[model samples]
Target: MRKVLKADSLFFYFFISLLWMEVIFRVSVMKQSYSFGILISCIFVLSLAFLFFFLCSFFKRKAGFFLSIFLLGLSSFIYASQFIYFKFFRTYYSLYSVSNGGQIVEFWRDIAAFAGKHSILLFLFFAPVLFLIVFGKKMLVFKSCSTVNKLSLACCALFAHGTGIAAVYAGGKAPNSAYDLYFKNSYPQLSVERLGLLTTMRLDLQRLITGWSPDIELAAPRDSKYIPTPAPSDKAKEDPNERETSGKIVEYNTMDIDFTQLAANEKNHQLKEMHQYFEQVQPTAKNEYTGKYKGYNLILITAEGFSPYAIHKGVTPTLYKLVNSGFQFTNFYNPIWGVSTSDGEYVACTGLIPKNGVWSFKQSGKNYLPFVMGNQLQKLDYKTMAFHDHSYTYYGRNISHPNMGYIYKALGNGLDVKKTWPESDLEMMEKTIPEFIHNLPFHTYYMTVSGHMQYSFTGNYIAHKNKNLVQDLPYSEQAKAYIATQVELDRALKYLLDQLEEAGVADKTLIALSPDHYPYGLDMKTINELAGHTVEKNFELFKSTFILYTKGMKPTTVTKPISSLDIIPTISNLLGLEYDSRLLMGQDAFSNASPLVIFLNKSFITDKGKYNAVTNTFITNNGKTAADEYIKRMSAIVEGKFHYSAKILETDYYRKIFSGNQ
Candidate 1:
């Protein structure tokens, strides 16, 4: 028994340590209900650790000892770092973020605070290393393994890996299943939960290097359109064909581009397939709201970490007025994307789902984005400009915004705002409004920065600046700090409205605003305090307010479910812009088309029901029944949206179709 222990001690330590880290990570960072995939992840982790063991066995006594220690330390650091990162950001750190992440240095203060708060868990991760250093020499044999032994270890590694793969296949190939994540798709958070972090990172690096993209296939067509039946007490109607009852022929928000002809002329199979797919998509019908704000000056703002909880009448009265007044969308959402702010901005401006693992906005810098409001309105002789309150080059907005047809400015280039940890949104509005407000028939985009993370008075500049105002709030310090930062945003909006009114364009201008994401920096407990109840994680966590306000506009409320993804198309239709609604992943909210709000994990909410992908269950609205067939069809549609959205980024599908005309 002693001899056997000496011979295999190193391997056992590696395997046990790796398994321990995986379990710890699963419990803490990946705090989701797992399935058989959890077992598969364990086996896969075992196989990887075994491979490390086998490779380490090739070294001599001294080298082997230090190598094992190095491997163990690396494993500990990866798990520990991911734990703190997820806790801090409410998302996993992707390899892409790491590669492009010089700005991460700015978050060192927050990271240090996180480390201090979670020191126990952080110490537990490194305990294995301490054990190896203390007792490794007495128990672990560092002698080089014989060729025969090496061969056996290698065989065991391969066999275990093969078994894990087999188990994954046995789990099934349904959408978001273990098999789909492993072989076809890449949803980073879900992938980490199911496949283990190391395997997910390996796949991410492989895809990144090899230019691999998710394989997209067309879903089977539905037998009939899903017309949701609203319950008796339901105020909102859900008829799929319900629209304005004017005695006029229905015209769709479509362009003159012949997709069928484009597909026939295209040689690339993927581009052809995309053209064919979009050609068959049903275009949204024009309604009474269409052209309601035609030829209006536009100011689109992607507010930082804004939510309905920030809509207090006393604190953020401007926000309250705008939200409650013009084009009130009671059931709106601002779904958190993988890349958070950049992805949210991409979705709102481009009407596309962000491609996972990479900065889609940066990627789109190189692609043709004819659909974004900036580009769409630019062609009509509108003076288009965009501003950000932070660094111009942050998230590569310098590249992406210009490609969107905006004369872009941020901290480094032009638009000088006071340099703080997070620059002031109010200052940005004050300075940039003058740049474009006087330019008649203009469209400007503002990416606000006041409501950024590290939500505390000490670390957050904006929060500290407005701390006195939130001092009397009956909530935790973090919650108050978050609200205080949003107060800055409220003031910024007030300034914008005043300026517009002064310029005699407030009535002629349309101001549309939505958040980049929810205040993920605040914990659920703090969020609950602000919300006055437990916020439902699946759907309600994302329920936010979308403000489409113009001076003297009617306070009409629409109860259809919508998301930031629908912002571009909704505004495009309302402003009477010529855009093919079929090409966008989201439909015009004012149109008769059924509302579908897709979350990051492929969970979706439609007028019919809310489908939670994690639980594989659907909850119908107002106790209305949804047939299994209906759920399956909606799931397929969601899957297609994800798949094709990625494909558009990969192939630059829009540029392929309209490159000649432009």
Candidate 2:
């Protein structure tokens, strides 16, 4: 025992422990593809362990042993906690998210249940610490090292770190590559997969401290050699209002702001570049459906965990009717973002992608969002109100929503919905409808909560409330519970429609509702069970229904791909709001502008096909080959959207551009 357990063995123990935790995290949680990133991660992780090893070596024998144990325990706990969070939300929480995660306690019951279920994996993560606590003293030396020895250890640490840095740079600067993720991008998942969680979080802290922002450069369109086979148009049917035009010219949904003038007169280089970029962007032409709902009241809702699976004629009749009745989008995707719900709302409401690492909506409270429905309609003398059935200040919506020109309300504020584990959306509608139903031409927004996760009958309050209704459904318990929660949403919509009809504004009120994200709370197995087929994880997992309906409208089907990002511009166009189309990242769904649906991981679906960023493959819609140039151009456009969106949050670009106008 004495011969094998040498003082030099301390480094081995530390290295093994750190590597063990990192490998467990990647395999159990991330399940990332085997790539050069794994090699880079190992180098970085080795460097980290060496630094810890040296620090632990400086303490006295007993003190160093205890310190080693504590460090290992703490590391294990951190990894385990991250795993639990990812399991619950299907997205890793950033340092910013953790700092603002006071509301995490609200899901304690669900979290506890998750821990119980994944306890085996948790034990695997903590196995290193347990091993250390049991045999660390016997297997390793913890005595303080000599001065010369300590100096040698310190040098080793530095050399290892330097080597790691060299390995990272050697990986090259391609998009989503190890080098790009480490230096330029803020993609949390990919960063963790490529650089390891420790390095990713370290860099996150560094960026947070230094106010580092990704550099954005203007992209020139790449010329394509391959020609596309033009298929039948996927545009929605011509509006009845346009059939009456009798050859009269159609107007486009655009404002008078000249981007050329804006760029020429701009002082800041960043804003000037933005203006020049927008100047070259072709604005969407006004279609027959443009301004079809002019002067109509708008009610936009971002339903919690809503999906196509939530829509069943028998289980959720109202949802079924609303989905199948008007403006049916066959390829609408509600892509999951970094900060799931808040990010989803930000994309749909603001027509901009959410910047990773920080809450973009909260940051936008101080910025000018002239294109959001709340601000756009409020300026036109429409009464605007926003509601949430959760904490008023959760995700800082209290600050963000009101800034969007809404009389925002939630549990802590004016709204009076009974507090529950997951509050009732129906009760929210019941309590708040009277406040604004009488206010004609109102633009109301809702962030519902009844459809929140922990899809178990015992854990979810909303699920229990409607348990009897879903009892007969032939599905897994989780799936049934998920549907039960959505049943509450169905009832809420029904109540809303009834009230609108009673107020004699059912036809005049245009209700546009979409999910904040897909039903991520449920496991993929359960989702597949409910879907009755194996849903493709990459692009199809995000496929959801967008509800755009009034009392009676022609049922128009749009086959072109769209996304939650397009909601703002689509609504803006339909309401005849004066806005610069080029300024928004999303095009109007009904516009002649080519349909482009962007996902969080830089994946995109265009009228031509879907491009999976992770696999670097494009699947054409009509089996015709897409030009490599087309793919490159689209990738550049996606990258630009992400880069400039982040810049908008950091620099308040919207306010800068519209300063004189505002």
- Model 1 bad stretches (over 4 Å): 31-35, 222-248, 622-624
lDDT (Cα atoms) of all candidates against the true structure: 0.85, 0.84
Q: Model 1, residue 493: what's the lDDT? A: 93
Q: Model 2 reaches what TM-score against the true structure? A: 0.93
Locate the minimum summed-lDDT window of 10 residues in model 1.
229-238
The list of candidate 2 runs beyond 4 A from truth reads: 1-5, 146-148, 221-251, 265-267
lDDT of 1 at 116: 89
Q: For candidate 1, what is the lDDT? A: 0.85
* RMSD (CA, angstroms), candidate 2: 4.5
lDDT of 1 by residue, 347-458 (tens): 9999999998899999999999989999999999999999999999999998899999999999989978889988899999888887888888999999999999989999
Candidate 2 residue 15 C-alpha distance from true site, Å: 0.5
lDDT by residue (tens digit), candidate 2, 441-493: 89899999999998888878999999999999999999999999999999999
